[model samples]
Target chain A: MLMILDYIKEKAEFINQALAETMDQLEGVPPVLKESMKYSLLAGGKRIRPVLVLATVEALNGDEEKALPFACAIEMIHTYSLIHDDLPSMDNDDYRRGQLTNHKKFGESTAILAGDALLTEAFGLMAAGAKNAHLPLDVALTIIEEGARCAGSRGMIAGQIYDLQSENKKISLAQLEQIHRLKTGDLIAFSVRTGAHIAGASQRTLQALTEFAYGLGLAFQIQDDILDVIGDQEKLGKPVGSDQEKNKATYPALLGLDEAKRKLSVCIEEAKGKIREHDEIRPARLLEIADYLLSRDW
Target chain B: MLMILDYIKEKAEFINQALAETMDQLEGVPPVLKESMKYSLLAGGKRIRPVLVLATVEALNGDEEKALPFACAIEMIHTYSLIHDDLPSMDNDDYRRGQLTNHKKFGESTAILAGDALLTEAFGLMAAGAKNAHLPLDVALTIIEEGARCAGSRGMIAGQIYDLQSENKKISLAQLEQIHRLKTGDLIAFSVRTGAHIAGASQRTLQALTEFAYGLGLAFQIQDDILDVIGDQEKLGKPVGSDQEKNKATYPALLGLDEAKRKLSVCIEEAKGKIREHDEIRPARLLEIADYLLSRDW
Candidate 1:
């Protein structure tokens, strides 16, 4: 456990440094626009997605340096989605990760453009990185296409619209899982798969990693739902039962608390099982991440 | 003139068909999301950007089929920008091309997501197209990077922020031009450059085409300003003098109506001259397109 903690910390620091350098290199962007983009992108977080990318690459014995741009690109996409989701027209949240939301700090218009710039520049960075890293053109193109499909209309955005529609309505557990699967699951899967594909993993290896990814994604969401129901207000930075208060569909809402926790355990175990089956790949950190999500309180 | 008009109309229909087929192929997107995306994309216009891509490829005697994906990609980017620009937080316009703006037709959140989807999927389509077109990897990477850079923070988004900041405030002529140059000019320049680059035109040809693109972009904006000041209202699907009413800085506002018209003429002539220098490329349609903009009212 301690070793995994140290690993995450080290990789997260590396990711943060790369992200900061990327922002510094954006010389052509307007100063204020760059500032807003950096605010969300550089805002300290668990850096889970990027860490997964690096860890997966390392697990596959690939060059971590070659994966850095992709790691950064995924993080940028994540940050942009958060920024847009926080807008008045969307989730309308005032704070995120203990800081003023983007639209709260920057005006809505700037916030929107910042998100736009981040999303657009993410592709630019990835393409440039692919060329610099000397990745094969076909591999680069496939990875790019995967990123777009996962993050675009058919994936995360689809989840968003569905989530919006499902609000204030009673939805079944299957429907709830479907939303999380597309909304957050696809990107997380893409992050891990990107690392595997870049590392030249076999098709069988890729398949195992993908299953592990989806399991981890679902477990993460279920944990969030569980925490929202039974979490410390001060520690969680929001009131407990807020999901219930909003009539939002959640795992615990549909299943009893004990059942939800049991489901989370099953997800974690299943995820770890998939990784363990590929023991030759050195997936210690990936397994640890699944366990971390299972036990995390906030 | 008649020939150029016919060329545009014919190419626009082809572009429109391709766009419709692309939308039909998006089976994974939620129906509502797809509907909103199609609303803006298929709303119909002169299809200027996509047409330029095809025309430039044709002028260089390259495979028009190979350039179709890029042409569609540029149009998608253009449509996405318009969708977001019409959002309440941005331009707050209620009508575009004689139809209700995206947010007006669909709710604000869906509209925002639709714009995001279009932007994201444009890259996906381009990547897939690059592979199908069998474009050289280096060339594909360069073009994708160019699209991202031009449409991103340092380019169109920068222009949008600057334009927002300068609203209702006095801005210098150079500043206003700078805003439009980034906002609209960069993408226009990208369109022509993509076609030229894909057709494997020489550095000299690319440089000339780039200059022509920028000139035409500025001329188009200047003509828009001229129309806003002195042209018919209903013909434009919006009222004239709207820019004046909002105190928005336009070419005509900054340089006076007659001077702005003169500037437009200069831009058109210079743009045509650049193409004439490369008569070996058979740039008649490109030259005529510049002339078309010079005389367009709405």
Candidate 2:
């Protein structure tokens, strides 16, 4: 257990360094725009998605250096989504990570451009990823296509659209599940699937990992909704009751808080069970992530 | 000459149809989001960039069918930029091509996401471009990388930042050129060069085409500034003198209208001279475009 925890810590540090280096490349951009991108990217958050990519690749016996570019790419896409989602026209939050949101600090126009810049750069990084992987061009292109699809309209953006439209309206549990699947689950699934795909994991292993991630992603979001409704603001690093204040429909809103927590526990159990099917030596980090996601108070 | 013009028109029509068909593939997206993307993409501009790409590829004896995906991808990137630029916080224009801007019709958040969707989808198209081209993965990845770089921060977005910062400020001709080179020239050069690169045009030809596009792009922007200063709103289909209203520094702002026109004339001449160096027919369509751009009353 200590070894697993130490492994995660070390992987987190490596991914964080890669992300910082990728962002530093943007310094060659116009100073104002570069500053705007750097401000949000470096604002400090748990580097979970990148760590997942790195860990998934390693679990599949893939080269870590080859996966590094993609690890950075997924995080950039995730960061850009956050910047846009927090805009005044969207969730309208004033702070993220206890720091001013991009729009608040840089103004709306710059913030919008910063997000645009980051999103475009993410593609650049992905294209560069192929070269890093030293895989055949076809393989790299496949990975990129899958990742971009997971991040785009058919995926995360669709999730966000449904989320926004569902606000202040009555929605069913199925609808909420659909939203969470796309909004949160798809990218998480993509992280694992892409890592496996790039590392040339076998079909069975890739399928297993994807199923595991889907449940894990759902459980993670459910826990997040539960935390938002009942967790302390200082610990969460943002205000509580925000979803309710905005009339945003969440798992806790559709299902009672107790029911939502129970559902999350089920999801975590299922995710763990799927991970258990893998070789005993592998999926250790994924198992830990599933457990931590459900157990964390924040 | 008339036959060549007819040929170009036929190719443009074919490319336009392909673009529409590629976009129509975005069908399964939520109705509202799909509408947002199609609203701008199908809004019917001249389709000049994509046409240039197809023409350049065909002129180099490359498969036009193979290049169609890239043609569509460039247009998507172009449309996404227009959508974002027209936002209330950016250029803040209410009209484009005689229609309400995306933000004006769809609201800011939708417009923002719509732009993001288009940008993300563009990579998907480019990744798919490799399949269409049946080329080596390395070549296809290079096309995507170069295209993204041209459109992203070190390219178009950076150009926009400088343009926004220079508003109402005294700036020199060199500074204005730098802004236009990035904002307008980079993408145009990409359109021409990417096509040539994909077609396996000789390095000499690609270099000539790039130089030609650099001048043509600058000339295009200078003409646009000139039109804004004196063109009719009714004919242009958008308000004139917007630059003056926004205090945007332009060619006319740096040089008198007469000198700006002279500079346009020189650029047109230089662009034509470069194209004339090519062995295949002198790109008469491009020359016509240069003339139309510099001489348009609107």
Chain A only: TM-score per candidate: 0.96, 0.95
Query: Residues A1-298, candidate 2, lDDT per residue (tens digit)?
Result: 4565576678777877887788777644898788888888777666677778888887778887888888888888888898999998888999887789999999998999999998999889888778756777767887778876888889999998888898889888899999989988988998888788778887888888889889988998998899899998877777889988988788888889989999999999998888686762287777887787787776
lDDT for each of the candidates? 0.90, 0.84
User: Tens-digit lDDT track for model 1 on B176-294?
Assistant: 88998999999999999999988999989999999999989999889888998888876776677778877899988888888998898998998888888675578888988889888
lDDT of 2 by residue, B1-298 (tens): 4555465567667777887787777644777888998899888776778878877786677777788888888889999999998998888899987789998999988999999999999889888888656777667877888887899999999988888888779888899999999998999999998788788877789889899889989998998899999898877778998998988888887798999989999989999899875795347666776676677664
Best model number under TM-score: 1
Off by over 4 Å in 1: A233-240
Candidate 2 chain B, which ten residues in sequence have the lowest lDDT sum? B1-10
Sliding window of 10 residues with minimal summed lDDT for model 1 chain B: B233-242
Each candidate structure's count of clashing pairs: 0, 0
Chain B TM-score of every predicted model: 0.97, 0.94
Docking class of 1: high
